[model samples]
Target: MSVPALEARGLVKQFGALLATDDVSFTIQAGARQALIGPNGAGKTTLINLLTGVVEPTEGQVLLQDHNVTALSSSQRVRLGLSRTFQINQLFPHLTPAESLGLAISERNGSGADFWRVAGTRPAIVAEIEELLTRFGLEGEMDQPTRKLPYGKQRLLEIALALATRPRVLLLDEPAAGVPEEERQDILAALSALPADVAILLIEHDMDLVFTFATRISVLVAGRLLTEGEPEEIAADERVRAVYLGEDAG
Candidate 1:
């Protein structure tokens, strides 16, 4: 059998006396889509940081394709085909969506700072950017300055930028946050359209979207892995109900 695309073994993170991640272990198989869900302050963000090397782990290891990447830097991880989008939109405010995404692809190719050469001047790069824009449903908004685009569009732009990296594994942190209900379906549609070869690990609050896209779901609470299973199994879990979903009902 093939090794998982990504795996965490006994991962732990600490700041002073508080344990931000408590011995979490999980695996994301190649081509699988998994969701990470938890209540507020459950250390979801901290776990993401640990996986991407933004924060060093106090214990355990992170493996990419069964190779230890625990000590790699963030940029190094990106180069290794691991990319992520933030919970908040991160973009070049003054640049149009096309320009921003083009720059991201350029950076991934290691030429992002070639300011004298306009990204549009490169035919191959331009074509790639346009393709990604269309794929992400941003073709119509491509030329608009990122700041002028609506919140949902900006969120899409962020995902587009991350996709520019051609990641083998994508980590999405709250892709649906702040998106109004009316626009959320579009986001979900775009995500569902992503290539099946790209393994995606999503951190999202919307149970509906989570259940719709995720093949498996992992629940975290107070920095620990509460449980992980199929969506129906997680939904029916008594411990998950008492700790997380019960609050959603209230």
Candidate 2:
């Protein structure tokens, strides 16, 4: 059997007396689309941080493809094929989307500091960057500065940048948070179309998109994993319905 694409075993993180993540444990199989859902302040982002090495866990381990990664730094984790996008947009405000993606791809290829070398001068790299932007539906706006793009477009660009790293596992923290209702579908579509080789661990509040995209769902509450299973099973679970799904009838 193949090892899971990502695993968090007995993970724990605390800020003073606050237990941000309490003994969290879960595994995301290769090629799986998994949703990590919880109400606000449920430690979902903290867990993402732990997995990506943004905030070191107070205790427990994070494994990427069965390799211990708990001790790795964020950049080291990215180099190891683990990548993520933030809840807030992170982009080069003045650079065009094309330029931003090109830089990202170049960095992933270890040529980031070659400022003297123009990305457009490299046909292969330029072509690849254009393809990524087009794939994520940002082709027509490629030449526009990131700050000029709509909020939804900026979010999409962030995902595209993470993809440029060619990650084995993608961690998305609230991909749809600030997106308008009309544009949310585009975000969902792009996320659903990620390559099968890439396992996704998504932290999202949009239940419609979450239910539609997640093959497996994990529920967290009070910094602990409450339950996890297939969407239907989760929906039918009495405990889940009573606590998390009370607003929607089972």
RMSD of each: 1.4, 1.5
Root mean square deviation (Cα) for candidate 2: 1.5
Candidate 2 Cα errors over 4 Å, as ranges: 247-250
- lDDT at residue 34 of model 2 (Cα atoms): 95
lDDT of 2 by residue, 1-250 (tens): 7899999999999999999999999999998899999877989988898999999999999999999999999999998889999999988999998988887788788887786876668888888987898889999899998899999999999999999989999999889988998999899889988898899988998888889999999999989999999999988888878777775554
Scored by lDDT, the top model is 1
Query: In candidate 1, what residue range of length 10 has the lowest lDDT sum?
Result: 111-120
lDDT of 1 by residue, 127-192 (tens): 999899888888888888788999999988888888899898999999999999999988999899
State TM-scores per candidate.
0.95, 0.96
Worst 10 residues of 2 by lDDT: 241-250
Clashes of 1: 0
Please identify model 1 stretches exceeding 4 Å from their true place: 113-116
Candidate 2: clashing pairs of residues: none
- Clash count, candidate 2: 0
